[model samples]
Target: MSAALKIGFENPVAQSQAVFRAVMMALARPGTVRRLDVPVDAVPALDPAAAAVALALCDYETPVWLDPALAADLQVQEFLRFHTGAPVTEARALASFAFVPLGGEVPALDDFAQGSLDYPDRSTTLVVAVEALAEGEGWRLTGPGVAGEGRFIARPLPADMLDRLQRNHALFPRGVDLVLTCGDRFAAIPRSTQVDA
Candidate 1:
């Protein structure tokens, strides 16, 4: 087995708890960047923050869909499976979570699972690995978690991301959420967020 497959939280319980808290805070305060402190050696073709998110959030109950680039990486697959126990799937709509790499082609927003009105929480949550993440001049975000409006900057998102997010927001109580990661930092953009480019 490769080193990456053996690399997981040194202290599974505490590390996972920290990562989970960071994830919750990020999602609770959209556009706010939170750092994940888990120690992960470089996993080939996998961003550390993305790996940490998967370790914290995915489990047997959550079926994950990987982008082609990530899906082809055996090390990444092994690491996630060993640590998260998440089932991998090729069907996007059936996925409860999806991992997409920066600069890769992303599927249409509608392609992911958008939960029914009765159970909006069943929708997929996307963990996107980006080149960089910072607060500055990029998309403007406003909605539930924002005090007023917040600025978020991440490079190489989908060309039609803003339009898609607008439409996604229109879905109201039934749309996917997003977690953007770069290195050890991540931020969230929930379905309740409105994005202006």
Candidate 2:
């Protein structure tokens, strides 16, 4: 007798490609936005959006970090290892990638990377999975990629962090990159874009 095998419609590699395309489109559009439904559960830290971000950016070259609340969860860690093939790293030393599952308050942005005057690219790229995104309520954005000016609220960022980013912009082309992941949607705010207080 022959046995039947089970197969499902979800393919991570395909999802990864779609994610890449979406991210590219977002970059091309700049302030524009897009959403993706990733394969994952609705949980404390690891949500569908978070999973989608991993699918798009995380790979062997990337390094990941989870908040203490969700860091040691075997399922989360193993899934990250299995899919992204990335290793976990310390918060102080930046890896190619970083995930802030803060789940509450975002840390001081400078704690991450603001880049150096010489090699601004040396700064870290941050992936923050947050609750939501809205306009005219968060921080004010100006400079490249933006029209005249834009405003958005992100909780309440630390004063020092704003200062660091200001310094990063002084370097112009050299500075840290940002990707804000909310739900299944994401926005990349490259260092080239200036955030004004």
Give the candidate number with the greatest lDDT.
1
**What's the residue-level lDDT of 186 in candidate 2?**
68
Q: Backbone clashes per model, in order?
A: 0, 4
Q: Tens digit of lDDT per residue, candidate 1, span 1-197?
A: 67535566788788878988999989999999988877865465767778777877889999999999889988878888888889999999899989997766778988999999999888999888888888866889999989889999887787788899999999989999989988889999999999998
Q: Global lDDT of each model?
A: 0.86, 0.62
Clashing pairs in 2: 137-153, 138-152, 138-153, 139-152
* Candidate 2 to truth, TM: 0.75
Model 2: per-residue Cα lDDT over 119-170, one tens digit each: 6666667666656666555567787666788765442334475676667566
Return the lDDT, model 2, position 166. 69
Alpha-carbon shift of residue 167 in model 1 (angstroms) = 0.7
